[model samples]
Target: MKNRSTELREALEEMIAVGTLSPGQHLDETELAARFEVSRTPIREALIQLASMGVVVIRPRRGAIVAELGPQQLVEMFEVMSELEATCGRLAARRMTVEEQQALQAAHQACKEALDSQGPDDYYYRNEAFHEAIYAGSHNQFLIEQARSLYRRLRPYRRLQLRVRNRLSNSYAEHDGVVQAIISGDGDKAAELLREHVMIQGQRFSDLMASLPQLGKQAA
Candidate 1:
């Protein structure tokens, strides 16, 4: 079972990701505690965790507020995430053990099941497992830590991207290409596929921002 703080954090993050909590909006501890049927301590802890993830800001006097990321900032962060994932994919192609490969296949299967079931929430959970398997398969501890750190920071935004119309099917297709390349030990292909898979660019970025209009706002 999840801890109170973690569950509250996830709920708040989802609300922010789906635009229920707009960027820069104030987070009232009393209101949230009442709404979630929790005490102020858990709310404070969740807000602190969100602050560390760059999802919320904790000011000395003003308390907590949502953190805004403009499109350019989001693009830059995605670029870094793409490169990190590409490195992991490239290394995994060459270094993954047989057991790791089996695990990756299992994760992919789970993702496929979720996709076939047409549950966005389920797919998202399986998708994270699939990517984490690839990261672990790389056998590079430092790279895994870096990728995971960035991944945690970007989780909400990435989850929001999945809410785009028909994005789940498109994402699953991309995952197929990536999985095949990695399993075949095609380092270059795996790297390229993984890079493209995680990096939302050009028209895709524009469309995502348009779909979630709250995400594209300029910092005030």
Candidate 2:
């Protein structure tokens, strides 16, 4: 049952990422169940999970609808995300154990492999693990929970960001800077690199809109 829910959630998230399931569109459980050859039980469970992640809105009587964040809202969220990640990076640089640092290096290597040998979709999944390692390395339970909550809300949009042209290579290079700063125990440098990495600004924001036209249209 857990696997079924997770599978449905991933499939739905991919559809959302690619704009097949546009924001604000109602999710018909019956149709989804038929399409996936599954029971409504799994579909409902998946929608519930998506709701918790901010991917869908579950209404009292109207059922589930794909979530839509306006441009301003998205920018606001990104701003907060940047600060949270910077904090994680700073703490991780100072607090991570030798084993944790080794794990982080392993995650970074996996991200490098994904960038070289896989498509944007594969890179997106690896990126999640890469960021997760930093979050765990922070070794601060309260900060970890806070970062995890925001991370879940931003996951789908962040996944779509990888579709931007040449983003995989560019992001990998940026990750290298972050890893170096963290490895050297330079908290301030790690914080700065992480902030810049997560904060979408100017041209980067433009690229994001170009990559995801649905967001552009919605924000317009």
Candidate 3:
């Protein structure tokens, strides 16, 4: 079974990712303890783990607050993410076992079902699994670790982007292309598709920027 600290950390992470706890919002240990019906020690441990993940900041005097990234920083991070995913795709195309390819397809199918039945939020979670399957297919431990770390830090923004009009459908369609390329052992094509799938540029960038204030207002 998962420990209390792990459970609390995941709960808090989801709250932040879904914008129930918006960026720059304070995380008070006392309030969190009361809310979770736990003591302060577990809350503090959870916050420390979140801090290590770049999801929250812990200051000496001010305690903990959700970490905030500027527009430029967000874009730069995505650019790096795109490159990392592209490499994963390329390697996976050449390296993935038959079993791993089957797993990736299963994950893609799960995303489709989530999109049809439960909409964007459900699709987002399944989509994460789909991408992680590709990450594991690469068989590169170091690359997988780096990709997951950045992916976790960017989870909230990525989730918010799916709220944009037609983004859910578009993302699912992109996943189709990525899956086909990898399964066909087309490394170059897989890399290209993965890069485009993850990169937030042009209108997507504008949409993300426009949506941030709305999320903040909703959180408020």
- Residues 114-151, candidate 3, lDDT per residue (tens digit)? 88885888898999999999999999999999999999
Q: Give residue 193's error in model 1 in angstroms.
A: 0.7
Which candidate number maximizes TM-score?
Answer: 3
TM-scores of the candidates in the order shown: 0.85, 0.85, 0.96
- Models sorted by TM-score, best on top: 3, 2, 1
Tens digits of per-residue lDDT, candidate 1, 1-89, equal: 99999999999987776467777789999999999998999999999999988889999988999887788888999999999999999
Candidates' C-alpha lDDT: 0.87, 0.86, 0.94
Candidates sorted by lDDT, best first: 3, 1, 2
How many clashing residue pairs appear in each of the predictions shown? 0, 0, 0
TM-score of 1: 0.85
Instruction: Identify the leading candidate in terms of lDDT.
Output: 3
Error of 2 at 52 (Å): 3.0
lDDT for model 1, please.
0.87
lDDT of 3 at 150: 98
**Which has the better TM-score: candidate 2, or candidate 3?**
3
Error of 1 at 19 (Å): 5.1
